[model samples]
Target chain A: MEENDVKNRFKAVVIGGSAGSLSVLFEVFPALNPRLNVAIILVLHRKYSGDSSLSDLLSTKTSLPTKEIDDKDPILPGHIYLAPADYHSLIEKNYSFSLDVSEKINFSRPSLDVTFESAADTFGPSLVAILLSGSNDDGTAGLKTVKEAGGFIIAQKPETAQMPYMPQNAINNLEIDLILDSKEISDFINMLNQ
Target chain B: MIEDEEIDLLLNDVFEIYGYDFANYSRASLKRRIIRLFALDKFPSFAELRYRVRTEEDYLKRFIEEITVNVTEMFRDPSFYKVLRTEILPVLGTKPFIRIWHAGCSTGEEVFSMAILLQEANLLKKSLLYATDLNPSVLEKVRKGIFPLNQMKQYSESYIASGGTKDFSTYYTANYGQAKLNEDLSEKIIISTHNLVSDSSFNEFDLILCRNVLIYFDKDLQERALKLFDESLGVLGYLALGSKETLKFSTIQARYKQLDKEKIWKKTM
Candidate 1:
């Protein structure tokens, strides 16, 4: 299949990261095209601060709609959804969101693998998953699941990332389709806008 | 790992054979939990899983427990508790007696938190804390009122943030790596097995808390559960839900007025 056809098949962009992902997100979020029609679901690991400010902070960095995910929220195109602290956000086959406060995987409530595996099961070929900068190997298994489901996978360049272990682990273990730097990642997303 | 057909098959078997209706629960969560249990238990095929659930009563207990999400904590969302302390309880304190129902109250962390609040307000004697869930084993834990010793540190912090005045340590005694709560707090609590999917409301309540439980249900089931709560709630009662849940989508939305930006609603009539 042609690359353009594959790009057009995408329905959601699920981004997973931890540790030093904040800096990479700031750069990429600011550059996201307002016209991009894919939902951006962010699964970032962090301490449970009893407030919903991360989404508010990211909303200031971009024009696209951004907010913390709630239970049973619909997955609308061109919206950004942040996984709430202390819960795992899941993708539903009906193109909506579901939440669980069950046991945390990999010491993180919003585990990347839980969401990624669910997204792969739900979205399958229509999913475009990106593994960003982090200090752990949480997203690697999720990326592998995404790839097995015929979804496209991208990893941030380890050398350029604030924390290299996350992307580096993926590059070492998986056949990532695109391993790009921050600027290239932004450009790739902008390409989808067209 | 399981397909939609397999999920349907399992749901039907559970209801037809076991008399527990879960067809109204959200398919997304049911699918995930079923897949997880299949993998964790190392069932060779879907057929094997069905056979065990059909014949073995013990496995059915485990299956029901897994399907219901049980993760809970004391004083979760401290700010929400803070509002309960300052605003909601003050009004409830004015009543001659108070009745609060903790529907789907898994392990009773939130119940303990509320009991503590009532005790602090000098209303524990007059208040009844009916903690109910579908799982009997979970209710056993609630009746015991013992939690991990290590978790108390975080619960203590959460208590302080929720406007608790006394030292949080006074509530429990730590021994054998478990903190057993005082009997006085659990005195007002009544534990029972109540299935929200099918059970009828037994008594009207001034406050009904079904936090995070309805998220596992489909939209129609959510509305059904909300209506059941409406039937069980008094005219001027309060209804609280999970932090991200709302009254906006349910049929009961019209009569309820939201309290500030919190997920709490007051039935105005």
Candidate 2:
């Protein structure tokens, strides 16, 4: 289905990435309308710290209200939540954050695979997953799971990514729905909102 | 909707035919893991994967690895180990016979780290470690007690951070870009295959380190694992979890006391 066709159906949007993710997030998140009813979650890699300042960093670039997710933070519309450093932030049935110190996958503790997989279990088909730029094959398996469970899948254009390994790996393993450049990815997000 | 019961049926078939029992595992995690494997094999359906797994032994091996959680490291959560050395050691105090269980031990990094700690604390002579996991593939590597040299730098940092008094290099001999932990560390270690879900406790221990494993389980499974640990821990035994994990919500939380602020719980009763 086209982005506009499924706009109102999704509960939330989830994006996963690693090494070369900042540029991709810069592109995709800005185009999302702050007024849209859907919330966005970004699971990125960072060192362990009590207060990760990622949401502040992204808020300067986008109109949406972004915040680093805290333990038990409610899932709210028009807000962007970046998974806090050093913990795998998951969505509970009550729409609250459930932080876990689960075993690492793909050598990362706050791994994209873990977040994407957990979100798929929570939201089911009402989820959208995007695999962006990164160096390793972290998000490939999780992307496949999201797609299988009725979620849409998008990948960054590998050639345009600073680190192509992750996008290429996911593209190699699964039939991704869209592969777009930064501007086009922004347009796609706008289209999803429309 | 794939009902939970159908998933249970699939898991049961896998265990009966392939000897890989994941039936009792947390349903959500088992579903995610199996779905991942199903995608990798390009099975048209979960049933198709189940059919092939029943007839193919190699598939069984691959399935075992897929279901098994292998992400671990030496002295992971350095602060926890530091607490173990400083706070728990004097309490243990070189018992005539000390038993330790490193449950869900993946490839044995933690096992070696514990052995080194016990040896340094002058408790090795009385200590025996039962290192276990559901996957036998990694147990073979644990038996060998070897790790890539590339990880040595990180492991060394964790060791020192965990309050090691000896040179990290003193514990291993480098050969062909791999560091083989000295044979002495493996001497008191019995590496074996054991499951937290399907298997019951076989031995009581003075300390049981089961970090980062319970978070994958749902509340019920978490409680189940805690009950097993509660049953397995000797009086006043120490139990450590991942830095983010705690005994707070589990059924056995009342039976244990927080050892330190680092998420270690001690059997209180």
Candidate 3:
């Protein structure tokens, strides 16, 4: 797809990671336009508890409003939604978020695979999924599902990743469209709104 | 894509035919699940799925399971169980007899988890755990009290993390790739089919656990369920929801006090 097509085709962007995602997100979130026209859903594997500081922490870094997702909360454009700890955040066909406390996959609750697969099913070809630095292969099958759904897939360049296993696994298992460093990924997102 | 009108009609058909109300469920979640079911069953469209749902008796049962089934595990969110063990159970132990309701107790994993906790506290003999769900199929599984043996490893880890007092292995016996929970644990549990959306509270309880089940409902249904919980709970009783669920946004928010950071609320009003 052309750069212009990339900006026009997608309705939502899902970013997933685990071990080293927060630092990368801190850099990327600020680079994107505050009023971008797509929903941005993030799943970063973290401890299961009520005292989540991620949404608060991300809100400080980005101009776009950021909040931890509540169950059945509508998915709105130009907002950043962080999946709350201990629940698999799924995208509904009617464009809302649903939380599930089912068994943890890959020993992580907020499983990237669950969210990515659900979002792929919900958004189909209009979705763009990015797999970032992490120690596990949880998001590999999910990115594959996105690819099968005709959505775009990007993996953070493994050589530059803090934890290379996650993105590397995706690249090995799926036809990833791009392998960019953190800065380049930010630049790509920034280009989407131009 | 199924239009809103199409969904509304389909939901109404479901209600009229099966008497299972999906009319007030969160539309987004319900639609997604329906679409998913359609795709999984290779139905041509939502209309086709709806036809089968209305006409076929077997399909209705499967469709209901597909929509309402919540995947759960033993001692999910160890910290919640930790708080329940250390802070909550002791308070309940002081009473003469405790009546606890596990509403929407899917497959009885958490029900048995609670029974184990009560047993360790020496309160099992005096406690009655009423485990209920909207689905009778899952309730049947709950009555058997058998879980796949493979899951025992994960449940054991969760058990230890949740501060189990005895060897977690002692709670079950493994055979034929399945583990049967001890009769002692199962004895305190009474499995029943109860719908939170349509059914009234059958018994008042000192503690009620309606965990991840509420996340599937829309605002109106959520408020209704909260009202039902409020009515069911005794004074100073306890209510526990899923980790992500909260009373903060509900109509009954002010009636309950936060007992822990893990979504345990106590009836204060």
lDDT of each: 0.90, 0.80, 0.87
lDDT per residue as tens, model 3, B1-269: 56668889988998888899998886655766776678789987777888998999898888888877468889988889999899999999999999999999989999999999898888999999999998888898899999999999989989998998578889899999999999989888888889988999899899999888998887789999999999999999999998777788888888889974678999987
Per-model TM values vs. the true structure:
0.97, 0.72, 0.83
Question: Just chain B of model 3: what TM-score?
Answer: 0.96
Cα lDDT tens digits for candidate 2, B1-269: 34556667777877787566565454545565676677777888767777777777887888878865576789877887889899997788756788999998878899899999999998987899999988889899999999999999999998998999678999999999999999998999998888887789899999998887775665666788889999999989989887656687777888888964777888889
* Residue A67 alpha-carbon offset, candidate 2, angstroms: 10
Q: Report lDDT (Cα) of residue A67, candidate 1.
A: 88
lDDT for A84 (candidate 3): 92
lDDT of 1 by residue, B67-150 (tens): 778999999999989998999999999999999999999999999999999999898999999999999989999999999999
TM-score of 3: 0.83
Q: By DockQ, highest first, what's the ranking? A: 1, 3, 2
Better of 1 and 3 by lDDT: 1
Model 3: per-residue lDDT, tens digit, A86-162?
Answer: 77788877798888765577898889988998898789999989999999979998898899889999999999889
Worst 10 residues of 1 chain B by lDDT: B24-33
Best-fitting candidate, measured by lDDT? 1
Best candidate, DockQ-wise? 1
Q: In model 3 chain B, where is the ten-residue run with the lowest total lDDT?
A: B26-35
Which candidate gets the maximum TM-score versus the true structure? 1
